[model samples]
Target: MRYALYFSPAETNPLTKAATQWLGRDAFTGETFPTPEADGLARDTIHELTADPRRYGFHATLKAPFELHPDQTEAQLVAAVERFAADTPAFDIPNVIVGQLGRFFALVPDTVYPDLQHFAARVVEEFESFRAPLSDADIARRKPETMSATHRANLDRWGYPYVMDEFRFHMTLTGQVPSEYAPAMREELDRRFSEFANAPLTIDGLALFIETERGAPFTVHRWLPLAPVSENRKIAS
Candidate 1:
């Protein structure tokens, strides 16, 4: 199984409910939801547009998926995640908006947030030990020849090309959309996620997601809140 480190809101968070509904699958619950209706898009088209993100569920990739290192065990990785979460303090993004990345759509921060970048980098660095070296197939799949020198270097060193300076935090919402359908898709996504548009998104926790096999949907193995016991109690109180 491949494991990924992702940023997802607490299960009770309103954004979690909204995002799961929008994506049509809840990673935490292993439950499927009906896709929201859109005026111009057929239900099948909607499903097709969402197929990729739905499989991954609703979350931002902090550390991309990788198999465990030969020296490591799953239990050790879980313990590390718990320790990391306990020590890390929570923060928030100033604002998030629906934006298109190439042909895909995602929730992206309106402004660059240094704290967010730092947090993601930290996760990648801290978890490097748990990641196995990329196989020949994995390297070929990334197309290192087409990538810039720095990205190729990153891929060799980190096992994933998008890390450190290359990372852009985005919670994907849909797969590649045809140019003809782009405008309408954006409008519908804006409507469906209107309540969260331009809203501050708290970075309160990270989740562990497991893919049972290649091309399988990931499921949430655990949700680790990034707050101390006392602070969490204070917030609850």
Candidate 2:
């Protein structure tokens, strides 16, 4: 079973209910309990992804999926995550939007936020000690021949191609929207998210997600609050 630590807003906030409805038992929707839409654009963007619940849903990835290291156990991984969460205080992400990134659709951060990206990188880096190096087959499957050298390098080092330089913080809403609906879909998403068209989105915590087998859906294992901690009060530093 592969496990990933994630950050899920639906688990804590009421504004994500509509998104949970759209996702049903897949992806982000299943892990997060039902909630209402925080912003109109969030509703529309999530709705489009849920249009095909079997495939898409809304949620951000803190740790990309990976198996436990040969010497590592699940309990150890969980403990590591807990420690990491404890050390890192929570922070907010400013206004998000339903934007088009190339040919795909996703909810993106409109502002240039270094903390969000840094947090993601920290997750991947901190937990790396617990991660097993990807097998050749795993690498092959994750990295296609069409991938560029830069992306391939990212894959070899980080186990994912779109990290660091290529990373754009987004919670994917759909795979590939059929061309015919592209225009109208974009319009609807834009109109719907207009309420939060520029509203700040707070990232208050972290979530742990699990997939036990090949055909299983991810479920939430833990939710850690990202709060401030006074360094001076540390037990040992």
Please name the candidate that would achieve the greatest lDDT relative to the true structure: 1
Stretches of model 1 off by over 4 angstroms after superposition: 228-237
Q: What is the per-residue lDDT of model 1 for residues 1-237, given as tens digits with 9 covering 90 to 100?
A: 999999998887888888888789999988998877888888889988899999998999999999999999999999999999999888878899999889989999997889899999999999999999999999999989999998999999999888999999999999999998898899998988899889998899989999999999999999999974466655874
- The sequence of per-residue lDDT tens digits that candidate 2 reaches over residues 1-237 is 877776667453643443454354435445543423534235555455545433323467767777778899988887877787778876667778887677676678886688888988888788888778888898878756879999888888878787775777776555566676677667765654565546677776777777777446666666777666457644432
TM-score of each: 0.94, 0.79
Point out the worst 10-residue segment of candidate 1 by lDDT: 228-237
| Prediction 1 TM-score vs. true | 0.94
How far does residue 92 in candidate 1 sit from its true spot (Å)? 0.7
| Per-residue error (Å), model 1, residue 169 | 0.3
| Displacement of the residue 116 alpha carbon in candidate 1, Å | 0.7
